[model samples]
Target: MQRKWMFTFILLVVGFMVAVQYNTVQQPSERDTRDIWAIRNELAKERKLHSELLTEVRALDETLDKYNASEEGNKGQALLETVEDLRQQAGITEQSGPGIVIDVVPSQESVAMGTPLHEISPELLTRFVNEVNRFKGLDMDIDGKRVTALSAIRDINGQTTVNGLPVTIPPFQIKILSPDIEKSEKLYNFLQSSSILDDFYLDDFILEINEPENNVKINGRSDQSENRYLKELPKGG
Candidate 1:
């Protein structure tokens, strides 16, 4: 009887140890599963928050656009007008109006064989450009190259150049733009009446002028440097 009781106690203790070991292993697996579930829940919450924030941002952008179109309309319009003026002044935009087109060509009959080919003088070209500017011409283009305020016309290596580019040989077009038909006509008359044409003819350069038309286009823009320098004025002197 004593032996049997000892064996039974030993079995009971072993069973209790096995149960404790099994529970210990199961507890860790359960805790790990719970941890994974908690992380998934947190990630879902963060994703939801991000989606809500994006929705709010979109709503705010829509509201701001509406405000800009309504309450801030005049300011927007003024800003647009300012931008348009700048574009016009910069010649970055294509302009079309009544203007004149002049073509300068070599008069073959006026020049004799074996004589030097009649070359257009850079000085004459410069003078003509200056005169047009003085007359408040809106735009000018030589051989499709835009003539800006800082354009340079000079003779380089026996070739007449405009802004450092050689104009193609004879019959190059010079486009001049004006604001209206009256101004265009006035400019055309000025060119015809001026002595410049007579001087050109004397030099074997044939200058041809087109009648003032309503659809002249000035499509070239300036590519000059954009750097500027300024000096501060004296305080009181």
Candidate 2:
């Protein structure tokens, strides 16, 4: 009887020890999962806050526009306005307007609307735009209108490919204003000599401009130029 009682005690002790170990193992596992979930939640909240800050910074771009009214800025704005006016007179679509928009196409015809010789590369176009942008109020566009295009010319990739679809080209549309064709032509020659037009070897690009009008609009909108916000308020801010 004593032996049987002792045996029963040993079995009970073994079962209790197992139960304790199992419970202890489960507790740590549950705590680990909870800790991981908490960490992820905190990270998500931080990411949302970071995105909000970025949006706030971009909103300041319009409010901080203050350089468009300077003397140098006015000249650029003037040049661009002339281009647009000339383009309108020439009957080219809005795509062909003032400031500069060069589109290069690969073609044998001097006047042929040819293929894009080089594939579009974002970096290449960006450099070209930056070079042109240094001119006070110079504006740019591609295919259509622009508030401001990160790429005056665009492509899907970072590099240009020959077999790729017709990519960025120039005079894609250009409009300029001059007292006469001579003056407008002079501007075109200046652009070439300045090496501003040296990036792409496009084909059959045409330039059009109209005679200058003194009362013409100078600055079309605020975002067209690097210096677009400083114009004197027209009686009101």
Candidate 3:
């Protein structure tokens, strides 16, 4: 009876050990299943982060494109403004402001003396223009022809010409535009006391400078010919 009891107790101990081993093996499988679920969750999170990163990158690219486009547009606008300003400075555009009108006509004494209406000398006209320019004439026109820096005022075939165009005898107009009302007033005052009038009188001509008008228009230069000798220089040279 004692040996049987001992054998039974050994069998019970062996069964408990097998049961513990089996439980350990089953716990590993359950742990493996849980690990798989955790791995799937981590993968899903990584994919979501990647998708968000891609979205942010695309948004940044669109913003960069808009910024580039805006920069280009600003450059274009600045170029256009610069060109327009250059045109104004070069006197290629029409200008209007407060200024005076000068009428060159035969003097009453000369007309009464029966001196024939003769074409005013180019030298006299040039001197008059120089005087006006000295007194701050911003823009000028002789007989409706605009005078530019390159204008030629000389005699061609015994006819007085301004910018290669003939001026009508004795009653032609010279319109001058000043920068502002104050300058126009000052110019008018200077002309009133100028010696250039005496020079015109010597040439049997009368220069009549009218009062300043608020709206005086000077037309743009008619000649738009480009200089053939003016070539664009090489970059940085």
Better of 1 and 2 by lDDT: 1
lDDT rank, highest first?
A: 3, 1, 2
Please tell me which predicted candidate would have the highest TM-score against the true structure: 3
Where does model 2 exceed 4 Å of error? Answer: 1-103, 107-118, 145-171, 174-187, 202-237
Q: Residue 73, candidate 2: how far off, in angstroms?
A: 32
Residue 163, candidate 3: Cα error in Å is 1.4
Q: Evaluate all candidate structures by whole-model CA lDDT and list the values in order.
A: 0.78, 0.46, 0.85
Question: What residue pairs are clashing in model 3?
Answer: none
- How far off is residue 208 in model 2, in Å? 9.5
Question: Candidate 1, residue 36: CA error in Å?
Answer: 99
Query: Residue-wise lDDT of candidate 3 within 78-185, one digit each (tens)?
Result: 557656766866668899988899999999998898999988898998998888877533889898888877788998999988778898887888888888989999
Of 1 and 3, the candidate ahead on lDDT is 3
Q: List the candidates' TM-scores in order.
A: 0.59, 0.30, 0.64
For 75-113, candidate 2 gives per-residue lDDT tens digits of 667557656765443324332223322334433454455
